[model samples]
Target chain A: MENKILNKLKNSLDYLSGESISSDLNISRSAIWKHIKSLKNKGYIIEGKSNKGYKLISCPDILSAQELIPLLKTNNLIKDIKHFYELSSTNHSAKELARGEINNGTLIIAEKQLCGKGRFDREWISPSSGIWFSLILKPNLPPMEASKVTQIAAAAIYKSLLEFDIKVNIKWPNDIYLNGKKICGILTEMKCDMDRIHYLILGVGINVNLEIDDIPDEIKDIATSLKIELNKSFKRSDILVKFLNHFEILYNKFVLQKDISEVLSICRENSNIINKKAKLITYNKEEIVTCLSLTDTGELLVKDSDGKEKLITSGEISFRI
Target chain B: MENKILNKLKNSLDYLSGESISSDLNISRSAIWKHIKSLKNKGYIIEGKSNKGYKLISCPDILSAQELIPLLKTNNLIKDIKHFYELSSTNHSAKELARGEINNGTLIIAEKQLCGKGRFDREWISPSSGIWFSLILKPNLPPMEASKVTQIAAAAIYKSLLEFDIKVNIKWPNDIYLNGKKICGILTEMKCDMDRIHYLILGVGINVNLEIDDIPDEIKDIATSLKIELNKSFKRSDILVKFLNHFEILYNKFVLQKDISEVLSICRENSNIINKKAKLITYNKEEIVTCLSLTDTGELLVKDSDGKEKLITSGEISFRI
Candidate 1:
């Protein structure tokens, strides 16, 4: 019912009178007024006068489920969206939710994360204005091949950023860089038995419109935001919806069509480190290697210093950042 | 505190008088009587006569923490044991416990599992007579190398069962066969990031003294118990402690010593299916192959019918029972 009024206001260019809005929907004028007041409280700038009624000037950059669910393109994916004003970590919440009978593609979003997590249990500062969310995927595939989900998610994120003019680079495994600075990160966690992955929590943190002063000094140079690069703020809601759209396409392709060519191609476009020198660390051995190519299963193929080619899986590759 | 009274009764060969038991325990006669009654309720046949006081006539085939923790020789392992009368699955319980501040090496054992889980979420029938438990391991190592934990557990189980003089063969990946029938299976689940394993739940389920009538008709031919083979009941408490001791030793060797030789050796001792015809199914690709050898990471090496040797990782290899 609120969506009707919200959509009506969104579509209206001129002022919408209370009597017309109420008669068109057969709702009370007082209820329409109440809904308009609520929308205004949620940061929707509304211009109202006794003669002109109300007009929506703008909408805030809020990642509310009421805002995203109606705009998402995915059918079975992300229909049930959980939005939190503040949370410890979306990934933690996703794990707890995935343990039950929750459907796949259920996303957990937070405006601010007190204890956001990064790779290797590292801390991820997820302040307001950044996109902090974790998508629960029950892609019950072989455990060894679960790494492909990270690649798919990276591709989705990379494609989502293409609509904007910002140049993006997806670092191997799951970090995104914009203008040679880290702008986004993906941390994939899974609960699985020996044979198959039961579920995977893909926690994604995007520095969408964060202010420079809000970022910590330790990573001020290394971290960046879309607002800083574009010299303007972006609606996190738009980026999030775009990400879910691209993600739904890629995920369905991988699950239904059994094809990951787009993911690999997108990753290949950003993975310009081929023939570049890097340090590859696997197990307990560290060696200098030259990046060669990616395998069909998202593993990195690198040539060791001794000129021997090795397929590196589940390893850390460090290059000159 | 309960262990103190339990241990005193276990030390007493014939019968300890209530007066002596109370004096030795520094407790009142009523206190001693209460402890004895509790022990009796837990399937221990405590025969109480007028003068003989209390005698532990017999003990059921129960895997009690009171009996096992006292005998386990592993330091810092299995010291914190939770014994449950019935549960859905010990691995599920272990995962919930691991989310807390519980230390590694904590064990969760249940007398019966209502919904015992097998590899790939298959149903594992865990009746009352079976041994069902899961060990929590926080081995801070690369996530891909977590498969080695399954190998280590299989080796530990094999070594622990050597005293029983039963012919046991460890099928590749995680299955224990006795005289050409399935006797035990291991399901290793993990909570991990892309980099390292946070915690691993090593679930071990063994059909110890299950009767033929208790066995489901669907799996009667494929499943057998120790009682079916040896025609006698074995104490589950003894087997659990033995497995924990072996597990601790092998785990320390893998984590502290950075050595997996003992695990590989023990696995090879029971993995003698070389030159035998088997169907190897990996990633949905099935082929008729001959079992050749085991890899350092517990992957099976097999020779296809085309005389091509291939490494089989994360697959099910089925041979004649």
Candidate 2:
């Protein structure tokens, strides 16, 4: 009944009357008043005038399903959204969920992660103020093409930030940067056979509302959060909704029609490592190379110091920014 | 005590007195007699007399750890051997074990599989007469090099069968054929990230001692066993020991030395699809091609109908034979 009353307030442009809400939801006026009091205690700003029953001013800055589900515009890419107050890691939870009977686009979000992980099992500092979530994807693609999902995620983040008039560049594989500092990171993990991918977990962590002191001393010099960059705090749910909308469009193009032109265009325009001198490390060999461009299939094209041009699929490339 | 007595009986060349046996182990004569009686009840053939102590005539044809551990000749690859009376699938058990702190060469064997699986989750008929097992491998290699493990498994099985004076042809990827029938199948499953592999489960199922009537009616025409081919049952433990020995050598070379020359030579010499026209199927596309040879990294080099040479990895190639 509280959710119904909240939904009614969310859909209203003006103040809603108590009698109309009671009649619409088949509840008593006293029950509606009690639910409104509960919503206010839960961090929802509701104005209850004597005549104008209630008006929802704003939702909490939490990624709960109640706040995120009604805001998502996706059709199939996001079937369910689950939010936890705290977890070890969203990727760990998504992996546990993928082993069972699960639908594609099931989202797992956590307010804070105690043991967050990045690519190559690196430590990822996730606090309650940041946005950390994992999306389960079951794309009908082969395992060799699995890395493209990471590229799509980078492009989506770039596109979503562009909507806020905040320009960010995407690093080669799946890192987003603003003012030459790391702002977001994406880690793509998968379970696969020789030819087919069973499932993929796309973990995204964005430093949304973290202050300078929240970052550790070791990485503070290289990391910057959105609140630090923009000099103000922004709602994490707003960014999540826009990212999901942009991701669904890009993911559908890559999966359904087998096209990545839009994603390529966005990535190429906002790429930070393209045409830049970087260090390429693969297996046991390391060399300096000038990144030429991104291939049609999202591989990095580079020219080594010896003037030998080669395409790299999987590696770690660090730019001297 | 029972295993110690069995080991002593196996090492003896001729019958010994009961007094000597009891004195050597510092146990009473009645205790030694009780252990020998227990061994006999578990299907061991013991020759005993009132004066002469028991002698081991033959061991039961079971793939138990007690029988297989004593016969294996490996240093690191076969660290632990676990045999279950029955399981749903050896691969399933190995996967569960891989999620924990398991050693590299831990072996999981089942006397019978109630729901065995082959490549692509195809049903495999595994009875007590067959050799069904999964070996957990933790190779320090990239994800793209995973399919080579399957090829190594095929070469190992082929080499083991050749010791029995039965020449078998290795079908590309991972299958062993005898007399133009399917005698063995290998399935390789893995848990990996984009850049590294955490663990790999190599599941092998060989038709060792099954009779003609033991096979399912649907696949009886295509499957054969060693007993059916030779009209005599071979010991399952013997075949398993040979396979483990051969597998350890090949796996070590691939992981430690970063070499697969031996495996490639074995595969190329006994390849069933090389130089043969076969139907090549890959991700909804099928074509007729002539297989040329095996590459150094264990990929199939083939020429399609257009005379274009291509290296085939991770697909199904079926010959008309």
Candidate 3:
């Protein structure tokens, strides 16, 4: 009821009277006042006059469900969005929820993460200004095909950022790079049996609007945020909605039709490592290799110093740049 | 302390005097009596007299930690064994524990599973006569190599049963068959990232001493127990202990040495499907094929009707009797 009134007030240029809101929502006048009071306490600025009624001034920059749900263009892919003010890690919370028979495409977003993590349990500094979220996906795919999800996410992030006129390049496997600095990281983890996957948590951390001081000194040289590059702030919802839209389309194509041609094309278009010399870091050894192209299955095709071509499936690729 | 008294009483043929028992254990006479009384309540029959202390008459067939821990001969593979009379499912309990920073070899065993499950959420009717348990393993392997654990477990069961003079044959992909009837099933599930496995639960359900009446009517024709096959009741602890010992040895080889050659040998020795015509059951299609030898990596090598040899990684095999 509060969201309805807030929406009405937001859509209208003029004021919305209490009597009109009560009739529009089938609630009492006093109920409207009560809900308005609650919305005010939630950092929604509103102005009211005796005859002019109520006008929505502005909404706080928070990833609340009420604020994001109205902006999403997805259907069943994202049945609902859950936004938290703070969390230990979005992936941790999503994994706990994924244990239950939750719906697919359940989104878990947080304003800040106390102990955010990336691939291989690396520390991901999720400050208050960045976008930290995890999408719980239950794709009808086998365990071996799970790595394709990272490419889909990478393509989604690359295509979405293109709409903002920001040239972003995807570092092979699952990282987003802008001008040779890391901008986003996607960590895909799953619980699976021998043949089937139970559930997968697509944890994505993007450095959106972080200031220079917000980044730790140790990683400041390697990490770059959107605000640091563009000298302006972006609405996190706009970026998130765009990513979600692109993800839903690519995910449906891959899962339903078993087609990844579109996602692969986008990945090829924006990859920074392809046709370039990079260091392939594995557990036991590291070697210089020239990354070729992505295989049909999304593996990195690389040629070593000896000119032996190999398909790199699982490892880290450090760009020589 | 109670296990100490029970062990001493179990080893002794004659009744021990209370004064001598107190002196040996360094506990008060009343404390000894209290421990003995508690042991008796746990279904251990004791014969007591005026002068003689306590004589262990008989023990109930239960998989309690006190009973199974002393029977296992493992160093670090089985750090602890927690046995319950009943559980929803041992794998369910073990997965919960695996989420925490638990030990690698933590074992969860149950005499009865009220809601037992098999692969793909199939119902596994676990009566009190069965040995249902899950072993928590933290192998330093990738997600793709997880299916090898099932082969190791299958090899362990096959080798262990051979020691009992039982000619058991392994069906491909973790099922134990004796005389063309199913006797055991192993379900291995894991939580992992793209490159590393966090933990794995090796859930094993064996039809040990279940009578004909205990078998579900729907599966009675296909399922058989040790008692039904051999016409005698075998001790569950003896079978469980043997399995644990074999599993510990095989698991150590696979995890530490990255060698599954020994396990593959055992699997190839007892496989009933090899050199026989069986139906390869996949999700979309099923076809009759002659099962060939096991591959080095433990996958099934089968020849289809077209004489094309293919490597079968994940699917079910129904023997064409």
Better of 2 and 3 by DockQ: 3
**How would you encode candidate 3's per-residue C-alpha lDDT over B1-321 as one tens digit per residue?**
888888899889999888888899899999998998998888899988977678889998888888888888977888878888899999999988888788888889998999999987999989999899999998877787889999999988887888889989889888999888999999999999987889999999999999999888988888899899999998888888889999889888887778789999888888888999989986446899999989998889999999999998788898643
DockQ of 1: 0.70
Which parts of model 1 have CA positions greater than 4 angstroms off? A279-290, A303-309, A319-321, B49-52, B272-274, B281-292, B302-310
Clashes of each: 0, 0, 0
lDDT of candidate 1 over A1-321, digit per residue (tens): 777888898899999998899899999988988888888887889898889888889987788877887778777877478989899999999988887888887889999999998886789888998999999887757777778888898999999999876669978888888887889999999888767788888899999988888789998878889888888988888899999899989988897778999899888778756678987766567788999988777888889878899887777767742
**lDDT (tens digit, per residue) of candidate 2 on A115-187:** 9998778899999999999999988776777788888898999889889999999887888999988999998
Candidates by DockQ, descending order: 1, 3, 2
Candidate 1 per-residue lDDT, tens place, B48-148, comes to 88888778778666777777766789887664788899999999899888888777878899999999988767899999998999989888787777888
What's the distance in Å from true for residue B14, model 3? 2.4
For model 3 chain A, give the 10-residue run with minimal summed lDDT: A312-321
Chain B alone, candidate 1, TM-score of 0.91
Candidate 3 C-alpha error for residue A281, in Å: 3.7
Native-to-model Cα distance after best TM-score fit, residue A256 in candidate 3, in Å: 1.6
| DockQ of each two-chain model | 0.70, 0.62, 0.63
N/CA/C clash count, model 3:
0
- Report lDDT per candidate: 0.84, 0.88, 0.89
